[model samples]
Target: MSRFRRTWLQHSLRAALALGATFSLGLGNAQAASTTKILVGFPAGGGSDAIARILAERMQIELGSNVVVDNKPGAGGQIAAQALKAAAPDGQTLFLSHDHSITILPMVTRNPGYDSAKDFVPVAGIATFVNAFAVSGGTTAKTFQAYVAQVKQQGGGKGVVGIPAPGSVPQFLVQVIARKNGLDLVAVPYRGSAPMMSDMLGNQIPAGVASIPDFIENHKAGKVRVVAVMGTQRQASMPEVPTLAELGLSGFEEVPFYGVFAPAGTPKATLDKLALAIQKTIAQPDVRDKLTTMGLSVGFMSSDELAARERSYAKVWAKIIQESGYQPN
Candidate 1:
């Protein structure tokens, strides 16, 4: 009917499309600017906190957003799990926990506040850490056999040993080793590793079980001695330390692991974004080297793989606990 009318209508459509594009761009930017908070279920200076801080630093730059690590420590991480359960499912918040908060806590406590299979979605695994049984330099035990000899000499075969917390991996390892060796180990539980080290140095505990890195430097400096490594293989940083398996204890390989978890309802898109960012960060040369030097093995597992790993450990730890006469309440 009219060329001018048709031309005007076409120009109007082009302008509308450009305006829609501009609006969409602004909305996306706003979404990206939203702060991402990661919850660490331990106090600062702990291993979990260290890992979360490292990952948070990389995530901030990789995701193009601000990220912060919020420490919520108490009740063996049940406090943090409850807080995470109440968090919105918008993928803005995540929980970084090791094996205790995920699998063991639920078994030991009546209520952990979050179910690993139902209330959370695994994002990515950061690393796996091997534990070590170490003693202060003043201890009479210089090696695993010597430790056994000292325990026997102590008359009751019940020697005081320190662990990070009750029902933690290190504690469980101590129980298992005590049973295997037919010794009575009165486990002394501490809030964290620092105090454990203090008591051990003060001779409050005759021996101690701790993470490999916690005493690695001390061992190297002749301040402490490692009796045995808990994992299957000797730690790379301490080749002289013998593994539990090598010491005639078969099937005692266990490592504490750290991974990222989101609220159960967090969208898959957000989880994928997080996993990608973690993979990129762990792949960095500096990050890899730093983690390795800390006596940790760099482990990058996908979400499915991480979940499977957790479940597998749950089954394994459950059996070990039961066999060790640990009646779950």
Candidate 2:
């Protein structure tokens, strides 16, 4: 090749490489596309997985990048939390979890494999949600009161209640309920909501306490009846259902939160950028409607706000878990 032509070709290649590098670093408008992954610590089709998928779709429109969800379901999200800790904090990986993995796990687990305080930083707080006490199809009881009465009359005040996972918030709620109602209720823990839900549908388990989303569809289909929700107020999607507080049960008035977190030391600019994308996604009417339908009180909280909220929730559960006399396994 001629010298001039070779020189021009070399310069062109250099410029293209520079542009690609900048874009790959998530810099500059009109940049090349990149992939961001949202990790869930549960199986697909679960509440957190569903929320991550929904937000990821809308977030792609806002951020103009490919977004995906990766599930690492095990040990009540321990595997996924450990994965997040080992990931590079380049803003490409995020963990979507509720207060269980971030708040309850650390308290109830001897070592959950990740340190939320040091290994992860809050990206965004999506919404607050409630746990529901639901009855299987084989049961005749409708209201929470009726369920308790039936258990007492038929089962000698001894009953079995299912929870999605052990050491979870739902289990603690069960303990509280058993004590309050004077029922000797034993909480049977499961690996995930899906199996626990299956038991509820098939009448293998008479009752369960899980996130409202876990049982909403089944409830709507008349497979299970959500007798009571845990929170200060009733869920808008199920206004007919009463809150535990309304049922004269106290200490469970506060709800749990859903949040996104990135590995520690991620750049502030990147965190802000992702947070804005999430905020925009959450602000979409369709997004809000979908999440609300699934029993989430859709709301947005900033990074700092999420940090404070998590701290406060930790304190909240700390008192509850301590009162329950739970020992980490």
Best model per TM-score: 2
Q: Would you estimate the TM-scores of all the predictions?
A: 0.85, 0.90
Q: List pairs with backbone clashes in candidate 1.
A: none
Give the runs in model 1 whose Cα sits over 4 Å from its true position. 1-33
Clashing pairs in 2: none
Give the alpha-carbon lDDT of every model: 0.81, 0.91
Scored by lDDT, the top model is 2
Worst 10 residues of 1 by lDDT: 320-329
